[model samples]
Target: MDRGEQQLIDLVNAWAKYSEATPDADVAGFCLHYLTETAQPAVLNQHSPVASPDGLYDEKWVESLTGTANRSLTEIRPSSRLAALVGRLSKYGYFYSKKAMFPLNFKSIEEPVYLIVLAQMGTPKKSELIYEMMVEFASGIDVVNRLVGMGYIEEFPDENDRRSKRLRITEAGLTILQECFPVMNRVADVAYSSLTEGEKALLIQILDKLDRYHAEHYKLSKNAGFDEVYDRMVT
Candidate 1:
């Protein structure tokens, strides 16, 4: 067949795959559904059973494929759609943020501790940053060691918790921040440059709400619908 016919067949095959049906087994069903919903009146009025132009296929062959696509979509659409959209949002954020960091020449995951140390400015113990950065205790220790070795930060025994250590960005770290922070700020500006100030505030507010909800409830909510999960979390 020509391009149009081949493309139509390919499109139906794709929908079958998306819906998690075997294309060779279920294609006729997908095609039948597509034609029923979208075909012209003349096509629908045809006397003979519908088939590929090669006459190797027929509408009856697709009879059981009916609603397979809808059933698949119904089962997965809610979670899948949210995952796809939110995943892209996170992916692009990381993409731009990485591009922002390229000039810093410190691409290791541990490098962010320098910025965190500067931002927190000795208000928090180095141990506490493990939770703040959502990393393991050992990981936080490793990063802190790396920063200390780099002379970008200095750690001191916490007065209240003698076993714990608080961190402060050294003058050297501040010097590096002078070079790096502007690049981060510029990248952030480009990333959110589409939003108005009000929209930015609103987005932050909404994200805070989502972050809190998910942080508290995501483990409990897995494989469960939102209302059921929320109810479980509340009770």
Candidate 2:
């Protein structure tokens, strides 16, 4: 068989696998699925957007790049590209979240998050809140103080540790959180609107995996030097 026949065979195989994996079968997303899975270096130009609501990939565009398959990720430097994209996306996340939060009286996304965590903990010691947040002691205390002053949360002396205080989300905090949930969901929707459900699920899986990986090393490497941290993490 010719190379053209072999490419067709591979494409069909990808379809079969995807059809099996997403039993409901994301037919529209298959275009991107093929491109990404095959890594076919087709120029996703101004005309050919990388992500589309419809998950469209052009067949003629694929045919135009017939000879590019032999190329590899080294030319693209996928890791660096991923890192840069993640950093830029974080800026977008902060921008949208900040706008959505203004009317709700949240200074940042961390406020609602702190309330949620404290609520779940059912009156945890202040140190425990800091540990759960993985923030510096001073930074965590600042957040706690702001919440206390806003009447969003309250802190009382910890009976178990006289020197430490305990914290709980106040009724006002819970009320604000209830209001914030739908608004925050809208913010998330704006961010993820371009992705198909299959793509969203895949993104969640990838991000969750990364979160788990970092959570394991977070405490152990907290105070370590850059070289020590990199060596420990990279290996």
Which candidate has the top score in TM-score? 2
Q: What C-alpha lDDT, on a 0 to 100 scale, does residue 147 get in candidate 2? A: 90
Q: Residues 117-212, candidate 2: write the lDDT tens digits.
A: 998999998888988998889999999998999999998998877998889888988998899889889888888888999889878867888999
> Which digits, one per residue and each the tens of the lDDT, describe model 1 over residues 1-235?
8999998897866686646744455545565556645566545445533333343233322332332222222223344435555676666667877777766766542475456555675657875666667666887677778777878878888889898878788888878877776777776787788999867876686678779987876556645897897687656
**Which ranges in model 2 have alpha carbons more than 4 Å from their true place?**
10-76
* Whole-model lDDT per candidate: 0.63, 0.76
- TM per candidate comes to 0.50, 0.71
Which parts of model 1 are misplaced by more than 4 Å? 1-80, 108-114, 121-123, 160-162, 194-202, 212-235
What's model 2's overall lDDT? 0.76
For model 1, what is the error of residue 225's alpha carbon versus the real structure, in angstroms, after optimal superposition?
18
TM-score of 2: 0.71
Residue pairs clashing in model 1 are: none
